[model samples]
Target: MSSITSFNDSLMSHQNFVLIGIPGMQEKNSWVAFPLFVLYALTLLGNITILYAIKIDPSLHEPMYFFLCMLACSDLGLCISTMPTMLGVYWFDSGEIPFNACISQMFFIHILQAIESGILVAMAFDRFIAIRGPLRYRSLLSNSVIAKIGIAILSRGLCVCFPFPFLIKRLPFCRSNVLSHSYCLHQDAMKLACADTRVNVLYGLIAVMCTVLLDALVILVSYILILKTVLSIASRKECLKALNTCVAHISAILIFYVPMIGITVVHRYGKHLPPIVHMLMANIFVTVPPLLNPIVYSVKTQQIRQRICSILHLKRTRG
Candidate 1:
């Protein structure tokens, strides 16, 4: 017990944390970096293409495309936020992050995550409006209203995540300063603090409940209502057509949420699992959605796919 106490005391003023690439597998980080870099590169390319497609085509300036653009932007932000630390850990063997930098990193990550959740809800709402009342959808989700919704999503994320850094700053990290992943997470950092963290834990739960859980519940309800509306259509073909519009959004939701839920479940209940399992899930939760979102949308969204193909064809002809 004395040894433990002394160890804790020694780290009471820790200002740097060493982030991990893959737990107990540090020697293989260079190999791990190859796949991760590919994913990051693809994420950047796909999302940029999506944005460019939307920008060059005025026909795609509707509410749906606007929300899609927002989703792409948020995914890009998530990738950019984690890229530095992630590459540092894998490529350069440089995992040490200053206290302030770690706090800021966590803050940006959580805020962007919250924004992404809100954007998903917004997309669901867009689908609901389109299917429920196509005539009114134009007036209801006009450019002004869409802009306001975007601002609200950003504001809400900022407000909800604003306190996280401060809350984490107040806690005393008096133990091992090695984070379990390439990036800093609020919950991961909170666990190393020597002081009481009830407030941090409670607030973190509340934030998740308010942002992620609430957004998911809202999306589910929107889809339920959309389903009812679709069912009322007498024609089977019409019902299928209505459902087709939602395929991309549903794919995006599953991509983001499944890995997220996997990470949560693994962290909470998979104590017996190998540490690599937990690390893999954490990395996937951060990386996979961004990599896959654009591809899913491109393949499932006809307009985006056509625009991208034409753009590629034009470049080829020019070359």
Candidate 2:
């Protein structure tokens, strides 16, 4: 307790921090750069391709496609947010970040993450309306309505993440400011601060519950309802068609959440495991979603597939 108070008292002098990038790699840390750079590049290309397909295809201007565009945009934001610092650490061994920059990075990364979670919920809602209320879905999710939802999504993320940096800023990082990873995570940064971080931890927990977990629950319930609705339909072909449409989205959601949850569990409870397990989980949690999201959407979504193929000058043959 005294140590906490002493650390809080010394909050004003912190100027920068060191991030321990891929500490488990040690000698192999340099090799990790190759994969990181490849993921960064592939993610950029995939998301850019998705955005371009949406932009050029007027058929994709509807709410579903628009939400996809938003998802791609958010993925791009997530990628760009950490790319520089991550690369610096892996490639150049430059792990030091100024205090303000670290704060900025954390704010953007978390906000983008929050935005992605909200977008997934919104997308699930879209699928729900499409499957359960096909006749009304169009009218229910008009252009104005979709636009409002997008705005609300952005606002929710911004409001949720706004206080995190400020909360961390108040607590002086008196202990070594060296973070466990190449990224700036709220909990990671908080632990570096020697203050009584009970407030930060509680708020962080509340934030996760309100955002990611809530979104996941809603999605699960939505799918259950959708399945029930589809099963009740008499036409087998129609049921299959509806499920097919959902497959791509389900894959994308799983890709994002599985590793994210793994990392979260590892971060909180897997302290007993090797450090490399945590690092690898952390690496894939962020990288895999962006890397696979566009690819899944492009391959599994017929419209997107056709558009992408056309962009590559591939000719489609009529069967």
Model 2, runs deviating above 4 Å:
1-13, 314-319
Write down the TM-score for model 2: 0.93
What is candidate 1's TM-score against the reference? Answer: 0.96
Clashes of each: 0, 0
Candidate that scores best on TM-score: 1
- How close is every model to the real structure, measured as TM-score? 0.96, 0.93
C-alpha root-mean-square deviation, candidate 2: 3.9
Candidate 1 on 185-250: residue-level lDDT in tens?
998899888899999989989999999899999999999999999999999999999999999999
Clash pairs detected, candidate 1: none
Candidate 2 lDDT score relative to the true structure: 0.88
Candidate 2 per-residue lDDT, tens place, 172-275, comes to 67777778878888888898877799999999998999899899999999999989999998999999999888898899899888988888999899989887
